[model samples]
Target: MSHASPAPAGITRRQALSAGAALCAGAPASAARRKPNLLFIHTDQHFAGAIAAHGCADVHTPNIDRLIARGVTFHESYSANPVCCPARTAWYTGRCTSESGVVQNDRFPIEPAMPDLGQWFGARGYDALYAGKWHVTGRDFTPSFRVLSHGHGLGEHGDATVARAAREYLRSRRRTDKPFFLSLGFLQPHDICYWVFAHTEPLAALPYPDLARELPPLWPNHGFDAREPETFRKNWRMGRIRQNMERWEEWQWRYYRWSYYRHVEMVDAHIGTVLDALAESGHDRDTAIIFTADHGDGMGAHQLWQKMYFYEEAARVPFVVSWPGELEAGKQDRAHLVSGLDVAPTLCDLAGIEAPPDCRGRSLAPLLRRKPVEWRDYLVSEAATTGRMVRTAGHKFIKYQGDGTEQLFDMRADRGEMHNLAAEGSSAGVAADHRKLLKEWEAHLSPSPAGRLTGTWDG
Candidate 1:
């Protein structure tokens, strides 16, 4: 298939095809049976453990749980970046934030030369439509997708409006003959940011009512680690911690947790609306649905509030892939390490299209099909420009470029990441191994000149 016009300034069709070729080599033979429509449902700042299916008992996400019931849940999923723009950019381009030139929120636009998810799929005869937040860049979504709705900025009800637009499109506009790639980016739980901002001032705490019983309890890792790396300590101070955490008392923190979960529930309701629309439209069975988030909020873990930290609360996110009867259902794959970078290539692989050669993500098609395949031993996630994390099966290692500080956690024994084993004599060999792995991983990244210096993990 020919492109609609010349490839953008930096992107070449040859490079795109090369990426696709590498991806296609591993796709299942059954992928040729039929092309499935793609329904990508993305949310903002949703923690991986927030959903009941993922073992969170506090939050109610029936709609998202429905997807989990019908799909494969990746228990160990990390974002490409802990910030918004970079993480979403990773999903769109199948490349890491550094490679895609969007390492931080609003700091860099997606390189025009990069072929986004919509453009790549659209060129392959799919109708790519997008609704809600397109935070990677500005309002120009022409080449990537036909914008159905860009919600009103910073308003609480915008997510509902975004869902309504997506529902309408799924019901009336989708072309049946050609496959469609519909991306629904909902903004909700992110509103907790506003809540945090509003509470920053010294406001009197409201009396705790019996209704407070509904709120989630403080996470076990709520206390700050005295031995935490200096970089992370500095980040906590630099982030909303001083403005948000320092002022709040224990009950206030619990209230904050309560508010965050409510916001998640709010978005889950919007998600249910879209899921109902898809089912009513009679296209539910044939469409491959993916549910994920850009990144996760801290949810009071380790006295943190928002993303851009390497802690599990901020870096990990929910990832579910569902294609009824075609892929494995109701199975949780906790053994494999997956990243947000894999979304685009996985979608392309499912659709039997070639992902761009420049993409760094590997397709999850084999895992979905329950086929035995060689997967990565570890995964890397970036926190804007400074922090880099590498997670193996048992341990997680984090290094920040700013102060050369480090953190290491044995995920199996310390799931809450309360202990930093990086400085311990007993864990020295493990830390060294992870550092070597990160060094090797860094060697493969193709960051732009500016991004290269913006804290690419050199050690």
Candidate 2:
């Protein structure tokens, strides 16, 4: 017996047109009438509470707010991992970070051959346009978009060039016969750059609020621990001294809040440009717009400046999905668990195409229409080394590798994750449930490659 032939190596214009024709014909009348276009706008290091609509009275993001007003705003949307490369790859492939073997920044590159969501969309007749930060490959590789325009200066914190290029892509896409998938990637808020002290720029000149920036309620300090490890204690002492000396412990807090808000404002401004162009092209109503971030920055929260932790500031991200008439406006989804991985599959499903069998995420179409489905009861997250986090409606359980370091918090009572119930509680059953989830997750962890190349790659 012979199997069906595989798809072409890369999505060609011919394949796109043929797929478009097939999709238009075989699809139901409503599906063929006007398939929703996808405007996937994402940023780096943005938190859930950073937006005004999400009870953040300070930061102003009107474009994002408009998207929320038109579609569902997932209050509890989270990243599978809170790091940069791994999280992005997971978002692209709809696979767990462990499966991708990209658990940290040092993992460097994700294989180009990895079946990515953009390629899937391109194969299905959606015109995928990628602009701004393209961190997926260690080097350049093929993107699903027919036109791959880059190196137009999408670098740094205060650059306006990338935003301009994104606007151009939107304007240029007006005449396409197919719906579009435009990815507007922004590099903001994530520019803490403090990890490399030598290369770090001063936080001077950035606008800061007058009020003292309150640290994350759950910020872990050495003094808070009864019996901290010697290594952790040493690091903590040094970190505190550096923070105190640089006044980074003080001024940087305000600076971070300032820069983060400004970056968000910058992203929103570009979004407005695109929105105006869409309106001009008469495609605003026909398009489905989604706004989210790859991951979040700690932004000095928990005494940590970046992600790779299970804290709310780093783990949770803002997610907004909008389509004018098909979706209910101004609605918030608090019950369903949405992951960054869900994006690609959801877009494919929305376009009336079957997501490849290997894709790990489910469609959010039902949730978008306010229809009921059996949403996940426990959402999982991963980070550096081997860490597992399970978040339910009211609690968050975290287990770090063999150190036996575990954390549990009643999210409803301690939204700040201030209290750790693992040390004190009669909830052995809850703890057991968390352990069961961990065991199941552990079963899924991909085995690390063995042998000589490990040492050289550990950088």
Candidate 3:
């Protein structure tokens, strides 16, 4: 319940050790094993294709790249729900949107039994601390986490404060006996929401004429398949931003992409702050850093602007894990399917603890430690209460509750997701197979009941 700011600078060495001992007292026998400190860093609306480490030359993210060099990057990572609240709820609770009861942002609360990362880890002897945005809707982060920063607003102004708080907390750590789990909730390129709103109307000329040549081009799938499901088409036209973006010239879309990349660069610098502090505190090797995002932005893919749909730009996210010498460095786990739910379970497994009750996620600890293990073949991500995506290694199938039309795409062949293979008779069986897999997957989740959600938090 105490604030998680750095302890007083003048505390005696004896005092620090005493505090550590107090925190470790009465923990289970396995808790004495000096678990790795967890630095859970996540950004908002961060596209999987935005980072320089992931073959993305659009943005320079040296800090994220640094973490990539330190460990493995999961090439196939998707958010549980491609939005702020539900995806974050899945991350913190290790449950899907239905189980978490957070189908949309703040419209409903999380199921009471579901413990967020702060509550779950704190109860198990970690110094569960938090900074920046805690967008899990109904949960108040203070009671469970020792708060470092509560600033929740645009990334342009508030992200630096979040970084500073994390850096200070890391710098203040003088002992490792009690492992700390510091969650850095950075609001970034999410600020691109502001960028989109400000530019809803067409511009007469480029804002900065000199920088026009420096702009990154639009994504290849700028024009989309109009043969999408009824629900998918409905979401595409729901927002004013979408309606206005329809009028955007090709150059304007390029300008929007350039702005989004710049916003990413902005947050990358803030991440560098926390990384610098971790190293300065001499805990780099002992801390496991997990970097990801709640969801991703459209960034002109399929001429879309923000999340809600099951497009790759919105659903796929960057998931990286680093623990220095203990894990493989500079590698990509491209074969396995992963979800936002795996994060909480992986951290628990790495810390030698059991996951939360009914946690419907498998640990990625085996994959990270390079041990042989069977893994899940597909991942399901929910959207707008009823929209669902079942993704396998080669193909992705999408459906909505009320819409009879479904869409399936060959993800391996078309990363842009331009083709809807479900309409073809040859691929109908493949789509049916995914539907079966989805039904089987849902049978396992004892979904927490809630009223259906229809609103959009697309920004």
Q: Pick the candidate with the highest TM-score.
A: 1
In model 3, how large is the Cα lDDT of residue 402? 67
What lDDT does the true structure give each of the candidates? 0.79, 0.63, 0.80
What stretches of model 3 exceed 4 Å from their correct place?
1-32, 451-459
Tens digits of per-residue lDDT, candidate 2, 1-22, equal 0012111111223432443333
Candidate 2 clashing pairs? 69-330
lDDT tens digits, residues 28-121, model 3?
A: 3464667889999999999888999888887899998998888899989988889899889888987777767888888879887678888888
Q: How many backbone clashes does candidate 2 have?
A: 1
Query: What TM-score should be assigned to candidate 2?
Result: 0.80
Which lDDT value does model 3 have at 59?
84
Candidate topping lDDT: 3
Candidate 1 local distance difference test against the native: 0.79
For each candidate, C-alpha RMSD in Å?
5.0, 7.7, 9.5
